[model samples]
Target: MLSVSWCATAQVFSPGGGTGVWRVFLDPIRPGGPFSVTAEQRIANAVDRIILKDVYFGDVWLCGGQSNMEMTVLQVINASKELTLASHYPYIRLFQAGLNKSLRELNDLAGIAVQWSVPTAEILGKGNFTSFSAVCWLFGRYLYDKLQYPIGLVESCWGGTPIEAWSSQKALSKCNLSFNVTNGDQKHEATGPQEPSVLWNAMIHPLKRMAIKGTIWYQGEANTAWHNAEYNCTFPAMIEDWRKAFHQGSEGSTEIDFPFGFVQLSTYHHRVPDDSFPWIRWHQTADFGYAPNPKMRRTFMAVAMDLGDEKSPYGVIHPRYKQEVAYRLYLGALAIAYGEAGIVFQGPFPKYFQLKNSTELRITYSQELAVLELSKDIFEIRCCTMWNYSSCKWVSAPIVDNFFNILSLSLEQCQQKVSGVRYAWKEWPCNLKKCPLYSKSSKLPAPTFIIPKNDHL
Candidate 1:
C-alpha cells in the first residue's frame, strides 16, 4: 500500500503494481529539517525494511558549469584558510554528480560522485577539479551566513564542456540547433564532452524530481570557439526549458521562473588579444550586456573581469580568486532571489551618450562612478566619413574630464565624426582591480560594452 501524509491529512492506496515497484507523492514541506524516512514491506512471514537518516529540507541550489565551477577549494587562493573555515558550517550540505553522459533523458542519476555530506576540512580540500567546488562551496557558505539556515548545493559540472552539452534537444531546437556531431565543428576538436544533450541526460535530467530553489552557472568559454554568436538565443532557451522541466517534475514545488545567476567569463591569455572572450561575455546576458533583461528575466550576473588570475598554477584561464567571485554572486542572490530591498548588486552601466562637440563626446553612467587611480586608455572610438567599417579605425579616446556620473572623452585623434564607442573591449583590459571605471557604492567593475551609432545619440 502507498500512503501520503502531511500535518493531519492522510491518503492511502492499495498495492496495485505487478512489477513490485510502488510510488507515492508527498506535498511540499517547509525548509529546515534533519528528519528521517523509513519504509517496510511484508509478504507472509518475511519482512524487508529500509531507512534514510539525517535528511534535510532547505534552499537547494544547482551549481552547473565547466571547469571553473568544478575547480576545487584546494586550487583557490588562501586555500588553507578556506578549508579550515569549511568546518564551521555544518548546515551547508554538498553533493556532486559523477561525470557521465547519456544519449537519452534519464529518470535517475547515473552516478553519485559525492553523496550529501556536511562540510569538513578534508572534504573541502579534496583533489583539484574533483568532488567539492570552490565557487559553489563559498557561495553556499555566504548564503548560510546571511540566511542562517541549511543550504543544499548540488554540483553537476564537467570541465571543457560547452553549453550545448548541458542543454536539452527541446531547448536547442528553439535556437535552430540540433544534436549533430560532425568533424567540422571546431568547438569539439580537442574536447571530452561536446555532444549536445548528453550531460543534460545523465546529470541534470535526473535531478528534476528533486526540487531546486535556483541555479548558478559558470560556462561559455567552450562556446567561444564557434557558438559565441548563437549563445544569445541558446543560453536563454536552455534556462526556460530547464525551468519548465523542473516545475513539471517537482509538481510545482519549484518556481517556473526561478532566480538564475551566473558568473561572466573571466580573462583568458593576458598578452593574446582576442574579441571572442568579450563577445561571449556580452552574449552571456543575451547581448544586453546585463541580466534581468526582457530576454532573460529573473536573472542576475557576477562580473569577474577585475579578478583575473594571471599566475594561477592550473592556468590563467582558471582564476584562483573564487572567493571574490562567490561573494559577488551572493550579493546578486540576496537581491534577486531573496528580494532584499536597497541592494546594489550590479555595477554602473552607460545610461546615455551625447556629442558635446566635433572632437568631444560625453558619456553618462547609470549611477555615481568612481575613477580609479589607474584609469587610462580603456576607451576607444571608431570614426569614418561614410559608413565604411573597413576604412574606419579605433583610436584611443582619452578621458579629458570626469565628474560624478559623467565622463568626457577627447576624440581629437579621430579624423572624422565618431561612428561608435566602446570600453574595455579586450580579453585582458587592465591589471587586477585596476579597471578605470566602477560603481562607487557596490565597488564592482563596470562590464564591457559597445554602443554603435544610433539616431537618438
Candidate 2:
C-alpha cells in the first residue's frame, strides 16, 4: 500500500465547551497497484471518509424554509414512534445548519456539517425542538421509509425571517424590492429582495460541493404572505443557483440535474374574509412544472393545499398532520426524482388562457377530465370557513369552462365587472370534493387563475 494524505477543515462544537478543529485524515492506498476496488470506488471511498460521516452517500435532501422548515419531531404529535422507526436506519442522518445572519461573506462554518440522521427515541423523547423544519423532517422520514436508501438532510433556515432578511445586500440592491430590513438599527429599503436565494447563499452555498439528490422546500409563508410580489423570476433564480452549485464535479465540468422539489404553503388562519389569496398559491403551484432551470432542466412542486385543515386554530403558527405532508413530498420525489411509476404527482393546473366572447374566459390545463362539466352543471360549490373543517357552506358554481370542453366560463358573469377570477384563493386551506383530476377531496385547492376585472384596465 502507498501512503497518501490530505487535510479537510471542519469546525465541531466541543462536547465540553467551545469549538475545535476536526482534522480528517485519508488513509493510504495502493499506487497503480491492485486493490479490488475500481478507480471510481476508490475516489468515492475517499470522499465518503473525508467529507460526510454516517451518511449512505446515495441520495441527499436539502430541506429548507422558515419556522416550518425548522419544525422538528419532538413538537409534532405522536412523533416518538415515527422518529424511533427513523433512527434504525443508520444511513439516514440530519445535519442542522447553525444560524448566522450577517452581510459579510460567511466563513467555512456557515452550512450544516452533515446530510441527515434518523432520530433516536432518546433524541425524540428529549425533544429539544431547537432547529428543524417539522414538515421537512417528516418529508425526509417518508423518503427514508419508502426508498430504504441512505438519506441525508441539510437544513438551512430561520424563523420569521422574510425574503429580504435572507438575501444579501449585494443581491438585494440589484432587485426592485419593497421590504424594509434593519441592519444594526439602520433600516434599508428595496423592492422585496430576491427571496430564498438569499438564505441559500449563507446557509446553502458552502455545501455546494457535497453530492445531493434533491431539495425539499417549505417556505413561501413569509414571502407570499408578506411580500406578495411576483416570484416567477426569484423562485427560479434560487432553483438555478442550487442546480449550478450541486450539479458539478470538483473541476466544474459536468452538466447534471437532480430533482428539485418543494411543498406549496398550506392554509393558515385569517380573521377577515378575503378572496384572491390563491393567486400567490397559483404562482407556487405553477412552479411545480413551470420553473425550468436552463442548466439542470427540471423542477417540481408538491401540493399542500389539501394539507391544511379549515378547522385548525385561527392565527396559529404551526399546524399538525405533518406525516401527510411528508408522504406527498415523498410521492413527488418517487415519481419525479426517483422515477416511480403510476403515481399522480399533482392535480390539473391551468397552463394557458384565452378570452372568448368578451364575457367568458377560456383555460387549458395539464390534466384532462370530465369535472369541468360537473363543476358547471351541478354547481355544488362549497365555501370553507377557516373555523370549520368538518363542514362547509354550499355555494353556486357556474359553468366556468369555455369553448374547448377543456374549460368554459360565463363571459357575461365574469365580464368587464370581474377584476380577477380565482379558483381557490385563501390564506388557509380549502376542500374541493371529487375535483376533476384528484380522485378524492384535496385539502388544497385546484390551480387558481387570475383575470383582470376590467378588460381594458
Candidate 3:
C-alpha cells in the first residue's frame, strides 16, 4: 500500500476572496478543510462536508455577557425580517459554545462542543433560539457589510449571571473585594453562578489562547440591582485581568490587549426608588475613564439609556430593540477598531460644568461630539424638582451657545429649586425615536447624565 506523507502546516489565502490568510494544516485529510478555531472548546464534533472550500479570513469577536447578549434572533424586535436577512449572509461564522461549569480552570471543554455554523435559512431555523447572539450578530453583520471581512462570533453568555461570577478570583483578590459566603444575608454562596470566578474558570479560561480582534459585552443587569457601587472598580479590574490572562504566555510577542465595547443598561421601568441602574451606569462611565492601563485600547460604551421598553407590566427589562443596540455598537467599532477618523463614537457627555450664577448651570463639551438635535425633540433637558430618581420633569432651556456648543439650564423659573439637571433620563418608555442628545458626527445618542448636586443652585 502506498501512502502520501507530505504533511506540513501552511497558511494561505482562502477559497473565496477572504480578508486574511487562513491556516491550513494537512492532517491526512482528517481534520476537515475549514472551520473557526474553537475558542473555549476545541471542535469535538463531525461535519457532513469534508471539503470546506468557503473559508475566509476576518476578525473573530468574543461576544460575552448576560441574557441580553445571549438574546437570539427569534427574540429580537424584528425577528422575521432579521432572520430572513441573516440567511443571506454566508461569510459570517458563529460558534455557539455550549455551557459547562468547572471549579477550576481547564485547558479544553469537557462536554459535547458544538461545531461552527454559517447562517442560512435552514441552519438558522435549526438552531432557533440558540442560533446566535442578536446584538453580536447585528454588530457582526454591520461590521461585515462596512468592513467587508469574514466575522466569527464566540457566543459565551448565561442569563441572570453576575459580573462576580464572570470575574476570576485572582482579579477579585487584586481588587480587594470581600467574597464571604454568609448564611444570614450574603449566603449567595448557595448559588453556583455567584461563586467567585467559577464561570470564568469554566467558560472563559480555555479561550485565553484563541486569536481574535476584540470583545463586545452586554451585561451588568445583575450587578446593578445590588452591587452597583462596586462596578466602578470591579468592572475595570475585570477588563485588566482579561487582558493579562488572554495575552499571558511565554511568548510576549503576541498582543491580546484589545478594544472592549459594551452596552450601558437600557432604561428600566423601576417605579420604585431604586437608583441601582443609575449608579451602575455612573460607575461604568468612571471605570472606562479610569482603566488601569493608559496605553491599552480604551473601552467604549453604547448608551442605551433611552432604549428601555417603557410599556406596562415593567417586565420588559430586556428591550427587544436589538437592531439599534447593534447600530450604536457599530459606530463605536468603526471609530475604535477600523480607525475611521472624525467618527463621533462618544456621545456628547459633559466635559466640564460651571456655576455661572446661583440660578443657572452651564455645560461645556466638544463640538464634534454634540449629536443633540433640539429640532427633532430627541433630547429632553429635565429640571429636578427634588434630589431623587425620576423626579425631574422636562423643561425648555436655551441652547446658550451652539457655535461654542454650550448648554445653559436656568433654575430661576422652576417652582422648586433644581437639585440637578438630567439629559434624556426619563423612566417611562423613553424618547426612543426622538432621543435628542446624540453625537453630531456619529449620530449616536447620548447616555443619561446628571450634574453633581454641588453644581446645582
Q: What is the C-alpha lDDT of each candidate?
A: 0.85, 0.52, 0.64
Q: What's the distance in Å from true for residue 449, model 2?
A: 3.1
Using all chains and alpha carbons, the TM-scores for the candidates as numbered come to 0.93, 0.67, 0.76
Model 2 TM-score relative to the real fold = 0.67
Error of 3 at 171 (Å): 1.0
Better of 1 and 2 by TM-score: 1
Candidate 3 lDDT, 1-457, residue by residue in tens: 1112233333343345444523232232331224423212113363222333455556778888888887777777767787899767778888766677666777665543346778764434344346567888889999888876578878777777888888887777666764543223333443766566767877788777766677888888888765677787777778878877777731332255677888888866645445677677767766332221252356767888767675623247777788888988888888777679876676666677665665555777655445345332223345565555467665544344354456665545555545545554344324565465556666666566655453542
> Which lDDT value does model 1 have at 215?
93
Clashing pairs in 1: none
Strongest candidate by lDDT: 1
Q: What lDDT score goes with residue 200 in model 3?
A: 85
Q: Kindly indicate the candidate among 1 and 3 with the higher lDDT.
A: 1
Off by over 4 Å in 1: 1-16, 19-25, 44-46, 180-192, 387-390
User: By lDDT, highest first, what's the ranking?
Assistant: 1, 3, 2
lDDT of 1 by residue, 294-398 (tens): 999999999998888889999999999899899999999999999999999898888989997787889899889998853446888887766666677778889
Off by over 4 Å in 3: 1-54, 122-129, 178-190, 249-254, 287-297, 311-315, 368-404, 413-429, 450-457
- The superposed Cα distance between candidate 2 and the true structure at residue 294, in angstroms, equals 8.5
lDDT of 2 by residue, 28-132 (tens): 222221112211113324632233223234456777766766666665657666666655655656677777654344435454533344555553335334645
